[model samples]
Target: MAEQLTGLAGDRVLLGRTSTAERVSDILRSRISEGYFPPGTRLSEDSIGGALGVSRNTLREAFRLLTHERLLIHELNRGVFVRVLTVEDVEDIYRTRSLVECAVVRGLGEPPYPLQGLAAAVAEGERAAVDSDWKALGTANIHFHRELVALAGSERTDELMRSVFAELRLAFHVVDDPRRLHEPYLTRNRELLHTLQAGDRRGAERLLDTYLADSLERVVEVYRRRVGEDGTGAS
Candidate 1:
């Protein structure tokens, strides 16, 4: 954990002069989304504070903020740990994603709707796949969806999906077969990008809707197997 925190020292400089709790939460949230702190892992205030050069109070406030985001849970005596999502939580996340992402595509006003971000995400996934880095591939997958949501051009929606995608990563972390989970989507993402690039908004929406539905089933299938009915896995 300390070693992982070491790499994040550069993020402190990114925060500029003062290290507010909001800035700390942003760093921690990004770490959690990137799989640095997987679900069910305990967060250490002492170690994280020393690493980030923040006060314990500030760290606790950051923890509190993340807890409100549903990415972390605090137990009476057990300290704070990353939240382990349930099957219902996964389903709900997909439902929310389908509604927002597809709507973003449907409302895209015109042809050639901002393809730069989506194109970049697809390329990122391709590079990860070529390297056989399934974990990085998964991160790229989320990036693809994030870029999709960005097409909406609404900061409120962006903020909402930011936490949703981070929570989605919690489910992805528990899947036993990362390749089986993430490999299939690379082509679909590329296809969707191409469809949008060609000015086929309806076609792109159809692809995205199917993509989210298929992905929900894939993740939930593995999620149930690994996490069990109680929502608690080996961790």
Candidate 2:
């Protein structure tokens, strides 16, 4: 296994199977998700490589991976940095989430969310919320929605949703209160589950759509507070 990442290595440990580049990517990814570097924060190859005992090539590869994932933004010469998530990006994400997930709920037959991987995901979210592990909570939140929508059984949709969730988690890192960002929805999620479980597909879909709309509004408001005209003074 890779050494326990601390100091320059940060929170992710290296796994033996992972190449130096992969390990570097994981560390950088985790750090970004943990809010160590906010959106638009610059990353230096020499600095990160030297700190992690990696090489420029390896760190470059890592940056490429995150950039592809939309977790990092690459510039022509200025260098890569965490994406300064714009209101447009945030809105698009929520819009896609609603379009996709609302359909998933509408498609469900009954009871279990049935991804063969959902209950565990929900349990993890509850644990993170209980322990106040915001990052884990974010991960769990993403996973829960994944399982919820995986019921639609579409590989393409699953891939798209995962991409959106990764970017959303980066946003989550900036918020001071994780639960406040998501806590208000747990009961709502439970209610949706109950509605689905009762074979009330119409009710579940309606509820989910409204919840998603309001949830999107909340996050976008916070995004505005942090990066919109009210905050960035850029646009």
Candidate 3:
């Protein structure tokens, strides 16, 4: 963990003079989403604060913000840890995603929508696949959806889904088979992109709806098997 904090020294520099709890939260949030701090991992305040060159108060504030976002949880006398989501939590996340993401596609006024971000994400997933890097492939998958939500041009919705996407990554970390979890989506993402590129918003929405539904089932199945009825992942 200390070594990981050491590597984040450069990330703190990006904060510059405007350092605040929100900025610290952004860095920690990005790290959590990227699996640098995986599910069930404890975040050491001393190491993180020292590495980021921030005060304990600032780091605690950042942790408080993340806890509010459901990305982390504070245990009594146990410090703060990345959240380990339960099966129900996974279901609720997909429910929210279906509501928000499908609406984003449905609300697009017309086709020929800006698709460069989606295209780039698809390309990134393909590169990761070619290299047989399944974890990177999953990250690309999340990026594709993030780009999808951005099409709405609503910062509020973007902010909402940003937390959702990060929470979704917690579930991803517990899956035993990244290939099974992410492989099928590679093609589906391309198909959805093609549908939008061809000016078929209706088709795109249908593709996304099915995509989310299927993904929800896949993830929940993994969660049940790995987490069981305990609501916590196996050690």
Model 1 stretches with alpha carbons more than 4 Å out: 1-19
Please give, for residues 1-235, the per-residue lDDT of candidate 1 as tens digits. 8988998986786465345888999999999988899888999999999999988888898999899999999999989999999889999999999999999999998786888998899999999999999999999999999999999999999999999998998899888899999999999999999999899999999999989999999998898788975578632
| Model 2 C-alpha lDDT per residue in residues 1-235, reported as the tens digit of each score | 3554345365344443247777788788777766787777899888888889877777888898889888898888899988877777778888989888988877766555554465577677788778977667667767778888788888988877867877887667556566688776666766766676667889978998999899788887777776673325253
Candidate number that wins on lDDT, 1 or 3: 3
Question: What are the lDDT scores of the predictions, listed in order?
Answer: 0.91, 0.75, 0.92
**Which residue pairs come into collision in candidate 3?**
none
In model 1, residue pairs whose N, Cα or C atoms come closer than 3 Å (at least 3 residues apart or on different chains), thus clashing, are: none
State the local distance difference test value for candidate 1.
0.91
Candidate 3 structure quality by residue, lDDT tens digits, 99-160: 99999999998557999999999999999999999999999999999999999999999999
Instruction: Summing lDDT over every window of 10 consecutive residues in candidate 1, give the lowest-scoring window.
Output: 10-19
Ranking by TM-score: 3, 1, 2
Error of 1 at 173 (Å): 0.5
TM-score (all chains, Cα) for each model: 0.89, 0.74, 0.90
